[model samples]
Target: MEAVFSKEIQSGLDQARVASMKKSSRLRVCADGKKQTVLRMWKTGFAMEADAPDMRGMVDLYDGSIHLFRCLVVTTAEESGERHYEFKRATAVRGTPALDFETPEHAPAGLIEDAR
Candidate 1:
């Protein structure tokens, strides 16, 4: 997919400066088509969320490099007061440095422990 950082995303990153100052990693934003997605990543784990006209409540989580373990959740509105939820799991190549997946001792908190 094609993605690019946009002005609105830059503004959000600017606002996240406070968090970065507090020792939290700065968040990154990229636009895929008309949708904007935010990604907050640290050494241990990362979280991504997206909301747009065609998509809403999209989330993805990963531990470490994000190529080994992943959990995705997509929520779509069906009708009045109704919503559809879809969940997916995948193991894909990210072309990043390989990580030792045998140990979870340093795994980030709030990650889906059983995502595999």
Candidate 2:
């Protein structure tokens, strides 16, 4: 279903959208940035809000202060009117790894030799 709005109302709504985009657009798709808000993402690709940059190639997916991934991407298709890209090479940037060493994996036999 579609609803029509008066020109004044539509203009106001457009202004609001611009404001919302500035304040709430937390996702970016450049090298640690995207041109605009990312509407959807996946393991191998992502979709940005309508009329996204006419761009392709390497980009980084970031949400707020967190880095998501570094990927080589190309425009693929559109989903629900949003532009989509496929990741040719997507490497996860999930922060550093942690090793919770409760104990050593292999103990020397000499340690047990003196014991029962």
Candidate 3:
């Protein structure tokens, strides 16, 4: 789907250091099942590699305008241990069209390479 609003965050030093960077976007998706008022959040990240930067992205879905409230959190896993979480600006948007599976043209350059 096309992003109504998008933002990205980069951390660390060089590409290696910036490997843990994140990118987030706000988009509208179809609603299924009963409850119309629903909110969903999900995260995606890369695998760690020797001397490679690890990156991740978080996606949140709700009903309303875009770019509303955003925050980060730290949590511990009972089995895996502690983990760091980061998010983009608070964003909410309404309306839905057929899911656009096409890659966004406005995506940052070298995003794929940097994730490697």
Q: lDDT of each model, Cα atoms only?
A: 0.40, 0.70, 0.31
lDDT, candidate 3, 7-95, per-residue tens = 22222233333233312222222223211121123562111123322223333433354532332222222111113233444343335
Q: Which candidate number would show the highest lDDT if scored against the true structure?
A: 2
Candidate 1 lDDT, tens digit per residue, 1-116? 97677878865775465335324433322224231222343333333333223333333332332423333445443331123334443334366768776757877767566776
**After superposition, candidate 2 runs with Cα above 4 Å error:** 1-25, 31-35, 97-116
TM-score of 2: 0.55
| Alpha-carbon runs more than 4 Å astray in model 3 | 1-55, 61-80, 95-116
Candidate 3: C-alpha lDDT: 0.31
Give me the displacement of residue 66 in model 3, in angstroms.
15
Each model's total of backbone clashes: 0, 6, 5
Best by TM-score: 2
Residue 63 lDDT, candidate 1, scale 0-100: 34
Clashing pairs in 3: 65-92, 67-91, 68-90, 68-91, 69-90
Encode model 2's per-residue lDDT on 1-116: one tens digit a residue. 99999988886776566556546667777643435567656777876655677557778777876888877888887544567888899888966676576545786646535565
